[model samples]
Target: MKPARFFTPENLQIVKRLVSRYPPGQERASLVPLLDLAQRQHGTWIPPSAMQEIGNTTNLSFEQVFAIVLAYPTSFQWRPCAPQLRICDSWMCCQKAKQRDNGIFEAAQSIASQYGVEVKTTSCLGACYGAPAFWFNDKIHTDATKETIKEIISKEFT
Candidate 1:
């Protein structure tokens, strides 16, 4: 069978460096960081080829790596996604949304869909004081409203 090659030479060096951080026989410990690096380098998703390469580099089975990746949905992106819109749907944010009747998250999903952005609901964004928070491409925006959400999505496309 042909070898699976995905990472660039520099990224391969980085993968080796990450693997070297652990004790000689514990390269499996580098799996998560290696997946993270591969995701970042590959523009946000880890493909099967990269998983195979990572397994080979770390002396892990392909199934082992795939299992770990599947376990952490938020950490790894198995497929490509448009810019993300992660809305906080935890207690404080939901309560605030209900009180204000702004439908911030719903509007965000609507706006994101128009722009081909992906919307995900997260537990907490750590901005409870400024509830109704969300992350546009990982940048937190607290005290958000539907208009603000629309504006943010609009700015992203333009």
Candidate 2:
């Protein structure tokens, strides 16, 4: 990927705080958080230089940082268009009031048609406590019903 351009000063400040969360001798542990911040700032998969910057800042090798990005779904390396909607397909979500029956699929198709949005399925959002949750862009909608899901698009999609 090309070097991303959205690593603004404000974002750097946030990264600085996250980096400080780790002990002084364990800066390498902050790689995931730094990558997360970078993805959030750039709104897509990380640019190589951003990964490199993470490595350089944390005293980790470039390869080590690159591996972390590859492993996390939290990485946002693409523009949010026909955007990725990871509907929870895990068992907990299926048992919820807003179960992932055909309705979920139908609504996803309809929304994708209406707003040109794209839908995807992820195993779990780590929000099993809030099963039937939906991920739009980087935000989570918990206890979502079909109408609620529709409302999410109507309210957020332009």
- Residue pairs with clashing backbones, model 1: none
**Model 2 scores what on Cα lDDT?**
0.75
TM-score attained by model 2 = 0.79
Worst 10 residues of 2 by lDDT: 73-82
Most TM-score-accurate candidate: 2
Q: What TM-score would each prediction reach against the true structure?
A: 0.62, 0.79
User: How does each model score on lDDT?
Assistant: 0.86, 0.75
Off by over 4 Å in 1: 1-4, 13-30, 40-45, 56-61, 73-77, 99-101, 118-120, 123-130, 138-140
